[model samples]
Target: MTKNDEKYLIEYINLKRHEYLNDLQVLLGYAQLGKMDKIFEYIQKVIDKCNDERTVFNSDMDSIMKYIKNKIEDK
Candidate 1:
């Protein structure tokens, strides 16, 4: 592929990665707010999306929790 094409692909992947991270953040926020059901439902949606894409997104709860904690602490 051309350098320009690779650059565009990188940008696209970065955007999608950030989108997934944002979704995870929202789900974690819901979980912390006593909305376990909502969290589970949203998590299932994330899982389904990952499965359909043949990708594994953050299977480790500790890492996921750490990311959320860092985001919360950053503010």
Candidate 2:
């Protein structure tokens, strides 16, 4: 790919990464509020979106979701 194309891809990935992080933050907020159902629902939605998009960060998403699940269970 051309440098310009690579640059665009990098930007797109960064934007998506930020969006995912925001979702995780929201999930954490829900968890802190003791909204277990909301936490599960939100995480499922994230997983669904990642599956649909087939993004490069699917593994990262899985790892984060697992971490969140463990945190919830620990509480």
Candidate 3:
């Protein structure tokens, strides 16, 4: 891939990773509030959300890398 394409991909990945971390922090805040049942419920939701996000990010990054590989091959 070209230098610009590589740079853009890195930036996008970093941005998404930052957002995911922020989401986890919010969920952790909910867990720390001393409600047993509610904390478990929130933790479960966080687990599900993290799983979904992982799948999506993996798919997206896979696609981006494939596209870059194709571009490099074409040149």
Question: Worst ten-residue run, lDDT, model 3?
Answer: 66-75
Q: Give the residue spans of candidate 3 off by over 4 A.
A: 34-75
In model 3, how large is the Cα lDDT of residue 74? Answer: 50
For each candidate, what is the lDDT?
0.66, 0.68, 0.67
Looking at model 3, residue 38 earns an lDDT score of 71
- The true-structure Cα RMSD of candidate 1 reads 12.5
For candidate 3, write residues 1-75 as lDDT tens digits: 678778766766666577678877776776787566876786788689768656655777667666545534553
- Of 1 and 3, the candidate ranking higher by TM-score: 1
Residue 3 of model 3 has an lDDT of: 81
Tens digits of per-residue lDDT, candidate 1, 1-74, equal 55654565566566668878899789879978999999989889888876854432245644544444444445
TM-scores for all predictions: 0.61, 0.66, 0.46
Q: Which candidate comes out best when scored by TM-score?
A: 2
User: Which pairs clash inside model 1?
Assistant: none
Best candidate according to lDDT: 2
